[model samples]
Target: MNQETKQIFSLRKFKTGTHSALLAKYGIVLATTAALMGAGAVSADEVTTPQTQPTTEVVAPATDQTSANVGTPAQEQSAVTSDIPTSVPADTTQDQAVTAVDNAQTTLKDNVSTAKDTGVVVKEGDTQEVVINNGNAAEKTSEVLTDLNQQDKAVKEATEKQAANQKAYEETSAEHERVVKEGQEHLEQSTAEVYQLIDQAKKTGLLVTETTTDQTPEYKDTKGLTGDELRTDMAENLELYQAAIKAGIALQDKSVADLKAALALYQANQKAYTQGNTALKDAKSSGVAELEGADGRQGQVIDLAKKNDVTIDVKHETVTPNYTDVKGLTGDALLKAINDNIALYTQAVVDSVAKQDGSTKDAQAKLDAYLKLLADYQAGKGTQSGIKWAENTTVEAGTAQRMTGNEPAVSWGNLRTAAADAIQSLDRNQNTDATFDHIFKINGSGTVIIKNTTNGDVTLKISNIQAWTAENTYLAVWGAKDGGIAWGVFATTHGTVTGGAGEGATGGNVGATGAILAMVKSYDYEVSTSNAVSTVTFNDIDNNQTVTLNGLDGAKLVKGRNVTQSGNSYSAGAGDVSQASGGVIDSNGIQFNLADAKTVTFSGSHFLPGYINTSIVAGIFGVASEVPKEPKKPNLEVQNVDVTVPEAPEAPKPISVAVQKATVTAPDAPEAPAPVEVSVHYYKMTTTPEEPTPTPTTPVQKAAVLPETGEAGSILSVIGGVLLSGLGIVGVRKRKED
Candidate 1:
């Protein structure tokens, strides 16, 4: 191991308890919160598709860990990718998984960077299939047919939409109902009277524009306008016009109300945005995350499904700052308390939440300051209304608003921002709910999903939430009316799962991660001695990347350098792997697939020649699906057209004649058997190859035939046969004479 790696690892050594707790925490937390994975081909985490999709299943009671019954890591790994990517290491699966942590810490920066910048993981899972040439074809086709038929059955799901339907509907319906109810009651009369007054008021030069008048909206009559009209009626009543004509009347009351509401929304947006900016800056300051020096925003994660591509959804979540109670406060103490709480609440989301938790010291400390400020104020430092600052202007712990010569005097804007943060997140129990904007400005915001699957296999859900175009990002989505979770999609990718390791939650007071994360405003910002402020966060550079780790011994971690196996194996550092060519392996020549490599072949040649006969073989290294040839027809056709048949005419029998070889030689060429030419060529027959019938073998009649003896026996037989035949001929002649 290199010296730098050893040093890094020594610094990263975890206490036994911390390591164990972290493992358990992550196992549990990750169970609740999985990576917001690419719906596309992702190796980060496999989609935990449920087996049997639910057939009136009995719910397994909640347990400390999920997937207990599903299988152990052994069973799961065996079923799929086998090993490498998903499971850290066989050793790492032990309690606390220290070795795995060491390995992960080394690769965290690369993994994170990949996820953020490229959304690509470094390690990918391997997917392969080998079709068996057995007799399951018909059965498989039948099963597919059966499944298709079953899909036509419509199942009415009545247990509510069951999941993502939890929140949007109720909120939306309530808002809609309010307008409907208002329309049925005081809509028309109010509309006509208001319009008349507005018109008359306009004639009297009381207002310059029609939009700012007491005009009624189109209802049914646009009943959707009832709520808005009611607010309008409340502000621009004819009574206000009459009051305006009076001697001491303030004629611009209606205008003032309109401006206030608009201003309120604007201020709320502006403050929240400013806090968001500050929180990010502070997070960078706190060393939680960095500017990344990335020039262009991706803005390209889009669904490739549309022409003009209507946006699916854009959402924002603002948190009402959470406050701890401080009973009383005054002067610098009260201001200090407010500022402290604001900083803490903001940091939680900005530093901790966004960066996957941790880093909320500023938020927690602020609450403590609030309590102190309250105590001091209740003891009577400031008046009931407010406290006056000491004329000395000497800066101390909590007295002066300004800290040092480096920091300028606190401006009204700063005071407003800090106060706004405090009030927005003010504790209602403390009768301090008036700071709505202040509390909400420092909380979480923004969520998005990228899915690339477009095979008509999409599942989507967007829950209850208000929509607004902020910073010019657009999203239009379909969602459940009252659901809390919004927007869902399905995507696909091409490669396998890669360098993905589950991460543990940041230590939050609540002790777990949320379904979504937002900016935190709870980190402190102090100018560092080097003129840098609050810069202390760990960033994973490889956004969604796969990491190849070495020395997962918990004894060491190495980065930006190669790893050694026994004698001579090696794996390049994160940057080196991509930059340098070829596969990565340890010194022992063990090339593990961390970056989702399909296969590795160092050097070889093709000597086998019994390959393709006609045309060229287009198949690449692996799957033959790449080769283009004729599609295979499994069962070949066989026909029986060669049936045997006996069909012809019978031949006539001729008189038989016996002739001796030497005794009777046909001197005249046997007279050619003479000119006896057959008039008709008797019968003709044809034969063809066919399965022949087997003849049975037997030991009957003492076995068989002797054709003739030898040369002497043949001579004897010839003479004897000739003599006997001649005698028989003489005897026949004698018999005929008698």
Candidate 2:
């Protein structure tokens, strides 16, 4: 046989012998393709190829065939040549077959690599046998290879997408962590600031406690949180704190103002107290005292230099006695001596009137003057004249009826006794009598004669008597031994006497004598006076006064009885003496009857505003009530604030991208190859089949035609076409043998 024919025959023999083996071998490939199809790895249309016409050929006999074969080599060659299309060259067919086989192998390798890279596992399943008809086996195989490549691409894309998803998730998680950390730090810082403010407020004396109202800022715990939750918590807390601080500051300002007002009030009260004390001091020193009138008719005098804003000048006089005969005597002896003088004087006057004659004008004038003098003496008004006749009066001894009528004897025996008793009972330290007037001190000793001319009774008298007036004037009367009357009147005033008792004759009228005696019984002697006096004067000067009491030498003047006295010094009581006498008498003997004798008077003067007790002034304007306490300062204290940084969002789970095994569905097997005509030559044969003689024809060497720039699927198509042709040849040969 020729070389091409011999190759054909050899392929046919191989196909017949390994048909079952081929089915088994390709079963896995078919199953893999089905798996890819089930997984939607590739489209069916992408794996399918166009069908091609089948070529008819002779099948080669098995290796065990006998030599008694009928067909010769030449005839076999002719049959194969007839089955081939006349329009196509034999060499071109051989080239297509070679290229097809190369493509198939490349496609298979690519599929396997994709499966490994994408982690696609091929699971076991019922092995499907894909029988490819020779007519379009190459195209079908090309389509199958294309499907496999597409499957691989889909898996790669899925892997890439999954990686991208993982990357995005990681980035998001990192951002979340950073935000959480920053938020936590910010929250901590804010909390510290709040605490610092609170501490400062406390230092300023602010009272700060936890927030009790929503309007004030308060602490918030934010732990184990992140993202929106953390942000929201921090924002709310910050707002509260800010509001609280603002309110606190306002309160502090108000407190300061209140304290200032309180301080001012306190100062004002203190100033008022100081002024009041000054005014009180001036009132105490403004009073002045003065004495007037010699008889003690007006006692001590006191004047206020300032009395409701007016000033006054106090004036006074002093008197000196002409005869101080009663200056040293005290008690009963003084009263008696006074009474004896009155009696002697009365007798002399009566005798002088008796000697006067009633015929001449001269004699009558002298008698009238004598009678007027006697009358004045009895009334206590003739103190300046002695008991004697007036000037220009001359009388001769003559018988004249007595100018005075007969009168009874006048006596003050009770007065003399009572006066003596009062003097003896006078107390030195106490005022025994409320109306006690004055002490007339008596001293010198004297003697006098008393003669009664009316009855020719004469009596010798030695004067050693004491006298004083109590509440009235009194006259003394005495009776002579020879039945004659002796009487006299006592006078407070003093004068010199010029005539003697014997120079007068006894010829006076009894009426004159009787009138003189009757006048002594009607005298009233009640008077009111005090040792101390107070007078208030108004003035307009606000100054202190220096009170100088002038005449209080033997007596001591005490201020509100606030003084010390020793020995014979007298104590003068405080306040007005008219209400109650406070003067104490001593052994030195104060003369209350004489104005200038032992009295007190004010010497200096000044002005005073008003009278107010010193003690009360101090208490009224004392310190003001306690100042308003400073309001507690506003404090907003917050300790450490815990904040939770939310855990970084879990890295987004890597996106699951299923990259199934890149499988290709085998193209539906091409239609069965058309039947090839075969001519069988019969020959008588013995036991073995005869072998046909090989023909000496020239061999056609065809180059395989491969797609220059195409996927491996194209080559697989050509390879499948060649294999199917070989199978077709084998089937035709076997049918001819039957």
Candidate number with greatest lDDT: 2
Residue-level lDDT of model 1, residues 207-314, one tens digit each, is 224332222222222222222333344233332322322311122334334434444444444444444445435533543222121101111111211222322221
lDDT of prediction 1:
0.22
**lDDT (Cα, tens digit) per residue for candidate 2, span 443-500:** 2221122221211112221122222221222222232221112222222212222211
lDDT of each: 0.22, 0.26
lDDT over C-alpha atoms for residue 366 of model 1: 31
User: What's the TM-score of each model vs. the native?
Assistant: 0.12, 0.17
True-vs-predicted CA distance for residue 733, candidate 1, Å:
99
Error of 1 at 517 (Å): 50
RMSD for each of the candidates: 68.4, 40.9
Model 1 spans > 4 angstroms off: 1-315, 324-328, 349-738
